[model samples]
Target: MSIQPVSRERHAHLRWKGFSSFAFAASTTLAPLAAAEISQAALALPLAFIERDGHWSMAAVLGLMPGQNLYVDAGGVWLGRYIPAALRGYPFLIGARADSEPPPCIDASSGLVTPGEGEPFFDEAGSLSPTVTQVMRFLEQTAQSEATLVDACETLASFAVLEA
Candidate 1:
């Protein structure tokens, strides 16, 4: 994916047609779960604790093998009743930038993006559109909550309360 930070200066003309399929996420074997949505996701997915560099994060196990997602069907549809928050925010991500709150980014190569014929990123007033603003807000909230969950998981690991 050609991920690039979104900015009015760079992508004012770009528009998002939105995606109709979950196929874009089919390559992943795990999907990160936001704390707020974990209960719902757990009802439909097996929860797994992923460890990296001694830090822990919770995710939904999508498949047993690498590069495979069992929840997404061959037709590009999601089979689960509760989708992970990380997968819901498709083509958009909160990119980390040093010490600052990360900026929202988009996959410019995601076919959903276009110069015309979709939801515009910026309005004629040169401000972010309401839709874009809402998406940004959701992405920020998801990232913040997931970070908290990761910290909690790391603490649990440190105390030996969580099993590998």
Candidate 2:
């Protein structure tokens, strides 16, 4: 995949308690791209870190509106350890079509679908009802599949929000 190079000098500083980190956080800029890719509005914008080249690399694929606790270090050293936590509490999704079985659920209202199953869910902001349970069963039966329940949950959550 081609990536555009950014710069540390142009990065923003995020202050948390007595500690501070430098990174970039912009949902408006990348959210649309993700939405287009996933074909859902409930895509999760997982945490990302600024690489040495100043380009962005996702630290982790956070599920639907996952809390700040899910945020973790991107496994880097020194100054490069900094990662943008702004999206920790923000909403993001996989923004892609499911390639596995037990397809994610969707909110008829929002017209968005969860990325997969076994993913996290927030409040009504992103909820999965009967559909979620079915997805769960599918995940339990499948083994060694690249697909994750979390991805399905993210897909459903995305759809819910889109309908809302």
The prediction achieving the highest lDDT against the true structure is: 1
Query: Candidate 2: lDDT of 147?
Result: 28
- How does each model score on lDDT? 0.87, 0.28
In candidate 1, how many Å is residue 3 off? 0.2
Give the candidate number with the greatest TM-score: 1
Write one digit per residue (lDDT tens) for candidate 1, span 4-74. Answer: 98899888977897779999988889888778888888788999899865679899999899999998899
Clashing pairs in 1: none
Regions of candidate 2 where Cα sits further than 4 Å from its true position: 1-79, 90-115, 120-164
How many pairs collide in each candidate, listed in order? 0, 28
**What is the Å distance of residue 9 in model 2 from its true position?**
44
Backbone clash total, candidate 1? 0
> For model 2, how does the per-residue alpha-carbon lDDT over 30-59 read when each residue is reduced to its tens digit?
211111123221334443321212222223
C-alpha TM-scores of all predictions: 0.94, 0.15
Q: What lDDT is obtained when candidate 2 is compared to the true structure?
A: 0.28
